[model samples]
Target: MTEHTESYYAASANEYAPFPALTESIHCDVCVVGGGFTGLSSALHLAEQGYDVVVLESARVGFGASGRNGGQLVNSYSRDIDVIESSYGADAAKMLGSMMFEGGEIIRERISRYRIDCDYREGGLFVALNHRQMSTLEEQKANWERYGNSQLTLLDEEAIGREVASERYVGALLDRSGGHIHPLNLAIGEAQAIKLNGGRIFEQSPVVKIEHGSPAIVKTAHGQVTARYVLIAGNAYLGDKLEPKLAKRSMPCGTQIVATAPLPADVAKKLIPANYCVEDCNYLLDYYRLTADNRLLYGGGVVYGARDPDDVERLIVPKMLKTFPQLEGVKVDYRWTGNFLLTMSRMPQFGRLENNIYYMQGYSGHGVTCTHLAGRLIAEALRGDAERFDAFARLPHYPFPGGRNLRIPFTAMGAAYYSLRDRLGV
Candidate 1:
């Protein structure tokens, strides 16, 4: 049995320097909770603005979903564009689209400027498994074009086959601007940059309580932080006590991934020749791509409750085989699962609780790019600019009804509905 969590990225984490635990009372211009992408990104931007920032992580840096995601730097919000346009009006939808486009650019620039070694790759294909999916892609393409996104290319089956290895997809949308990167390294690099800019980060120091109001006080087990602003960027893994109201706005869903042993160069090339990340347009999607070392990392399936790493592989490896029968005999070298936050509307939740306590979460599965954008917007809001951030904040969100006691049941009902729809290809 693999001793590690079986996450391919975790097995290959770069040498990250240990951060001191939060053991004493501290003060800062901003105090951030959760050291994943959003928190670290917020810290980096805040520190760059010459603010004294402090970040507190319950576990080690990148210990949550940031380290274990499929690493697809996809654009767009979790909610479908049509839903956004219909619900929030054309003006708000346009702002959301522009923000996502800029998000991709922000990730690219950070990777370049910080020299992060995260196997960053541009170019991604959003494939459609059926004619209905093809129609959806066409609609999506039209939507993007209407919003002035001319870089998106609609690809037929033959064209998609040339771009991807499998002939399973009927069509695809090639987003030249979106791509993938090693997520953990990116998070770590951002933390490093924050520290270099005179910010402090504490790992294994989970915030247990937040005393809301001006100059909020966040208490960890052994320490406390008083700051003019507090940012809750913890997303799914956020414990209940820190911000119970914010936590109730979304449910925690688990996503699983597995990586195959390195394949021969020729074999890997045949599987995914272009090295672009590919995700199908399914309600429960299957996303996979070749690693820098030629291993096939495939991610799919969902669990209502957290399970052991070993169980994660057992459940997902068969899904991988279904996608690539050529990998029938290849052994899965790593397997892991991470929790993701999902809102009732499937849109991210961003806004301040009391004007000074800003929080962002519930990106669903589109966090790689969304979190970076959120960080910048949150920073801008801190600097007294809320125009862009308000666009997302204005999108209404409903708290999960039934509270914590019945949250899982409601989520199960919702998931079952989506699962049935996915099966019926509706």
Candidate 2:
């Protein structure tokens, strides 16, 4: 068994193929940096197209946020729909919404076709913790309908209670298409698929620098890869040295989660009778759902200027108790924190830094399904199709106003404002 941080998923990761470290210069059709979901997915898609591909990971596969997320495979871009509409207008918003709807389907298809055992479940709920939130959900439902997404069903407080244990929510918008899965398992499975397709994945092979041109060269500690193109899918874990320009565009926000000891099956049923994933509409939202083993995996709290896991349980456990006081007596078995990137616009940043070098990151906690779609689009772009990739490439993204020295302060202030809004219920 591999040594891993104490995450529930880590405790259960399936045994997977071991990838060798890149030890010598190599050549390929594409050199993909970051072996998380996006890189692995791109590698698999590109390899299936018969392109020679090499994936480099700084640590073991899925060691980044890919392995540590809350695992909700949600729909909708990380930004609010209104933001998308106001910025891109109705047509572009409609297009983006349709793309996200299809993104969910892409995840389902991949799971079925690959037979991945990631504990996937459909039926997710977005709850409104108060009347203000309920009204917001109504507006969202109207907007989604305008975009021709009629599958969203509005549920009143009574219905919400039936689906979730918390009386905190006044109503909810149930999108059957949205769901959750074992994210780490999905990442590992995708890497396996890439290998089975004859692509190469080099674990612990961190790309220290890239020489970009027609045939890009990615240099690692022990080896280098020369390829026709490159893809940077490092997301939040793209350490400062690899791509400083990309790193400056987003701030790493630390989020924490805790899973309780398994509740009796009946008790778990009362909490989420339908076994649906639930997230409230708060700026710093509280998301919780039951695991397959009947544990309440609660995720909440944001820590600025911190990466230590020691403070995670203290920050999140209270929020969890507030939602489910019933779990007060239950033992908290697993607690961990993961860093995710948050862009100013909350939209994913995707485009090529150079003509032949492509990069995708800044999903803002909405990467579960979106990353998979991004992988496919990346593969398509590598294979001479750039239409879909161009749509996101054109989405505006601004770097954090202050440079490194002040970026954290700026983000902390922004987070404080959002936290106040969440508290004021505005």
Clashes of each: 0, 0
- Count of backbone collisions within predicted model 2: 0
lDDT of 2 by residue, 1-426 (tens): 233567998998988867888999999988999988788878888998899999999888888788988889788788867789899888777667768666677778878888988999888899998788899889988877776667899999999988888768789999888888888998888888888889999998878899878888999988999998999988877877777889878877788988888899999999899999999999888888888899889898676543665667788888887888877878889999887878888899999899998999988878887888888899888778888888889888887768767878888888789888877888
Residue pairs that clash (backbone atoms under 3 angstroms), model 1: none
Candidate 2 structure, TM-score to reference: 0.96
Q: What TM-scores do the predictions have?
A: 0.96, 0.96
Cα distance off (Å), candidate 2, residue 330: 0.9
Candidate 2: regions farther than 4 A off: 1-3
Point out the worst 10-residue segment of candidate 2 by lDDT: 301-310
lDDT of 1 by residue, 1-426 (tens): 112244788778777778889899989999999888889888888899999999998888887888889999887888867888898898988788777577778888888888888999878889988899999999988877776667899999998888877768888999888788888888888889899999999988888889987889999889999999999988888967677888777878888988899999999998877888999888888899888899999998766544444587778888788778888899888878888888888899998888799999989888888889888999999999999989988988887778777877877787789878877888
